[model samples]
Target chain A: MNVTVKTFAQLREITQEGCFTLTLPESAVTMGDVITLLKSRSDKWSQALGASAGSENGSVLMARNQQLCDIQTHVQPGDELAFFPPVTGG
Target chain B: MFALIGDADFDQQWLYNRLRQEASQKAKGNVGAIVTFTGLVRDNNADGNILGIELEHYPGMTEQALTNLVQEAITRFSLTSAGAVHRVGRLYNDEQIVWVGTAAPHRAAAFEGANFLMDMLKQSVPLWKKEFTRDNSRWVEVKASDDKAALAWLREK
Candidate 1:
């Protein structure tokens, strides 16, 4: 399956890629799987998507099909996934 | 009504008047109060004096999230009307960054409606802010106080 991944704000700055298409195997069916694949691509990817340096909280936020979701959420073919920082707008 | 504007300033008076007009028409002129809030970019943060800031948002999700917020406020507070406009992209200090207006038959509802809108907006909106100072720039961290404020509403129920 092909999923479109989007990174925003500091995540975008760190990864240096705004949007891209990722090819995932049928076994990689969850957002966690997607993160696992991306984190292995490079050190920048790992730092951007991995848990915070010294904190338990995940450094990045995730969304599936534009709605906020967690790593356990399922992802299907053609889904749009987004990764960003915690919201800070008023 | 809700909008995600970019690189442009919105007319506060225009939105206020529009809300009043719509609320009066919808509620048969029973609207007794209209409340509005405008957020401006401060010139400084804890790091130092902020030269400016840039805002980014997930395009489709941003609109949906803001609209949901306004609708939730209307239902929760019995507001006749509610609207919000947020600016994105590059913005200078002291500039208007956001505007929210609410109208109701009483002052209390209007006041609380606008407050609820702002509180919820801070927590759920997908927009992110990056502040630029003289020597460095950093993404604004989410405030625990904001989460507390939003949760306070849930506890009220």
Candidate 2:
């Protein structure tokens, strides 16, 4: 299966890529699995996706198809997953 | 609820006329009062020396949030019409940044409805502001005072 992944703010800056097309194995089926999979890809991703840093959740927020979702949400082949920092708006 | 997020400066009269037109059309003899609130960019935040600010938002999520907020206002206040617009990008001092307008059968509802829209948008909308001063820039944090203001409204209901 294939998916397009996106990251924003520090994640994007760390990854050096905003979004990209990628191929995923059939065994990887959910968002959590994808995060783990991405972590396996590089140390940079691992740090950026880490559970917490200095008490915050690594300052990354994930969205599947533009809706905020947890890591366990099921992933489809053509899904667009975006990762960004927590919103700071009024 | 209507929201415009971009690099453009919104037309103030255009929005006002648009909201009035929407209220008039939706009224169809039902609405008896319309109230609107507009917030402008000021030179100061809680901290001094805010030269200007930039607004950033999640494109799709921001719209969804605003829609949900407006729907809530309509239901809560029995509103016939409601609209809100928040400008994005670089905004100068004293420039209009946001407007929330509501129409209802009575003055209290209209007033409360408009207030509700602004209050809800401030808390729920996935938008962030960065304030720039003469020497530095910093992200604006959600103040406890804002939360208190929003909470006060709930007590009224």
Candidate 3:
């Protein structure tokens, strides 16, 4: 399956990319699995996605198909998954 | 019915009057109250004297989140109408950041529904704020107090 990943705010700054295309095996089928795969690519990827500082929840927000979802949310082909820190706007 | 999210400036009075006008058609004499809350960009924060703030949002998700919040408020508070608007892009000190409101048959429901929308905006809306001081700019992180505020609403019966 393929997924388009998007990062926002500080996550974008860290990744230095706004969007990316990734091809993953069926076994790697969740938001967390995607993050783990990225972490395997570089040290920066590890910390950026590992657990952000000041995040009491210890992870960035995950959105699957534009709705907030848990990392365990299923990922399918052509899904849009986003990652970013906790929202602070009013 | 639903909310708006964009980078354009808004007229708060126009918004309220519009909501009232729309509700008057159906609510007639029943809508006796309207309540609104506006968030403004301030000059200071823990980050010191701020020059301005920049807001970012995930376009589709933000509108969906706000619309759902308004729907939840209407259902829970028996509101006759509800609306929310959030501004994105660079906003200077004292500029409007957001507006969320509700109209109801009574002041109590209007007040509660307005508060619910504001709280939900802080907790669930996919909008991000970045504070810009003269020297540095940083992404605003969600405060522990904000989570507590949202939790209070959830705990209410």
Candidate 4:
């Protein structure tokens, strides 16, 4: 299964791209798994993903298909997943 | 009322011209004053460092919030037409951050309408600001002053 993850703000800088697609196995998955996978890819993800000390609980907001979602939400193939820091705009 | 998700810069001249055109199109009634408010990004914060600012918003929620605010303003004050545009992404110091333009038959109405748009936008809009300093970055939190301003409007209504 492939998921296209959209990154914004701090996450975008860490990923160095607006969005990227990743293949996940057809097994049970959670936000924690995604973070672990992302961290394994590079130190940037490890730091920005909150695997590093002093990071804000990863504070990365999650949205599945444009609607805000919790970390436990079930994700399927082709799902549009997004990660972003706390939004600050007016 | 209009909202957009893009990096387009605001042209004051063009906006003023459009507002005049729309006002005429609406009616030639004794409309007196047009009130406009523009928000810009500043370089300094409490930390006293100079840098840029970044704005982020919830896509769907942002449009919905602005629409509701415009409707509320119209109900509060008999406005002809009110519009606002907010910029997203990284912004340099002194860049136009947001704008609110209101047209009404009287100064009071136009003034109230423009104020309503800005006050409500700061309080209710699901947008956030991040201040970038030379040494560090911080999320701009909603201030008590904003709450007081928004509350004052509600009290008057």
Candidate 5:
């Protein structure tokens, strides 16, 4: 399965990569699994995605198919997943 | 409901008239009030010595989210029409950043609808603002005050 992953704002700066594709294994069930996978890939990704800062669960916001979702949300094969910081615009 | 996500400054008179026209066409001059709010780029934030700001947004996601907000405002406040226009890209101080307007048969709903749109927009919209000073730039973090404002609306329902 494949997923389109995107990062924005400070999250993009931390990841050093804005958008990309991720190939997920059959074992992957939810968005949290994908984040865990990315965190395991490299040090930069781990640090940027909030995994290392101990703010991974709450501070970071996630969206599936462009709508806000929880990490526990189920994933389809080609879902678009985005990670971003809390919004600050009016 | 209407929403526009662009870099150009929006015309306030046009928005008001458009909303009024839409509502009148729907139900013969029933719109009694139209509340409009415009957010401008101030010269200062927490750091006093600010130059300008740059706004970033999720192109497709932003439009969808804003459209949903406009629709929600119209329904939640019993508004006849609702709309918003958010500016993006590099903006200088004293420039317009955003606009939200709501129309209803009464003044109370119009005012409340506009307020709800703004409060929700500050937190839920996928828009990020970066402040620029003489030395450097930094992303503006979400404020607890904004969350409180939006939460108040939700709890009332």
Candidate 6:
């Protein structure tokens, strides 16, 4: 299955790419799996998406198909996933 | 009238006029109060003078979130109408960053509704801000005060 992954704001700065496609195995059914896969690609990916260092300031926010979700949230093929920093605009 | 505008300046007066027109149409002259709030980009943050700031948002989600917030404010406060406009992309200091307007039968409802919109917007919206200083730039950290304000609304219920 292929999923479209997006990074924004500071995460984008760290990742150096705003959007990309990731191929996942059938066993990888959740956002956590996607994070784990991306984190393994490189230290930068780990630093940006890792659960511990998530971002410089705080935990990264995740959205599946533009709706806010958690790592445990189930994902499917062709889903759009986003990771970004905490919101500050008003 | 909820929108996530990019780099384009918005007219607060137009939003106010629209709210007034909507109030008159929806309530038949019953609305007695209309309130609006505008957020400006400050020239400085805790670090010192800021040259400007860049705002980024998740495109599709941002629009849906603002629309949902406006609808929620209207339903919760029994407002006649409400609108919110947020700016994205590079913005200079003192520029208008956001605007929110609400109309209701009384002053209290209108005031509370506008307040609710801003408080909720800070916490729930997907937009992020980055401050650019003369020598450096950094992402604005989420303030605990903002969380407290947003939570106060929930506690009020």
lDDT for each residue of candidate 4 in B15-59, tens digit (9 for 90 to 100)? 766776677677677557788888888778776866888777756
lDDT of each: 0.82, 0.72, 0.80, 0.69, 0.84, 0.82
Q: Summarize candidate 6's per-residue lDDT along B17-86 as a digit string, tens digits.
A: 8878878888986988999999999898876899999899889888877887888899999999999999
Report the number of the highest-DockQ candidate. Answer: 5
For candidate 5, write residues B1-157 as lDDT tens digits.
7899999888889988888788887767688888999999999986586888999999898898889888889988999998999999999999999999898999999999999999899977889999999899999977655544433432332
Clash count per candidate:
0, 3, 0, 5, 0, 0
Point out where model 1 deviates above 4 Å. Answer: A52-56, B144-157
Q: Which candidate wins on TM-score? A: 5
Best by lDDT: 5
TM-score of each: 0.91, 0.77, 0.91, 0.62, 0.92, 0.91
Candidate 2 local lDDT, residue B55 = 77
List ranges where model 3 is wrong by over 4 Å.
A51-56, B144-157
Q: Pull out the clashing pairs in model 3.
A: none
Q: lDDT tens digits, residues B19-82, model 3? A: 8987787689898998988888889987469899999888787888778788888998989999
Candidate 3 chain B, run of 10 with poorest lDDT: B148-157
lDDT string, candidate 1, A11-48, tens digits: 89999989999999878988888888889888999988
Relative to the real complex, the DockQ score for model 5 comes to 0.53
Comparing 1 with 5 on lDDT, the higher-scoring candidate is 5
Writing each residue's lDDT as its tens digit, candidate 2 over B1-157 gives 4555556666767876776677778767776887878788889977676888877776776777677778789888998878777777778788878878887888999999887777677866667677889898777766545544433332232
Q: How high is the lDDT of residue A83 in model 4? A: 69
Model 2 pairs whose backbones collide: A88-B128, A89-B127, A89-B128
Instruction: Show the lowest summed lDDT stretch of 10 residues, model 5 chain B.
Output: B148-157
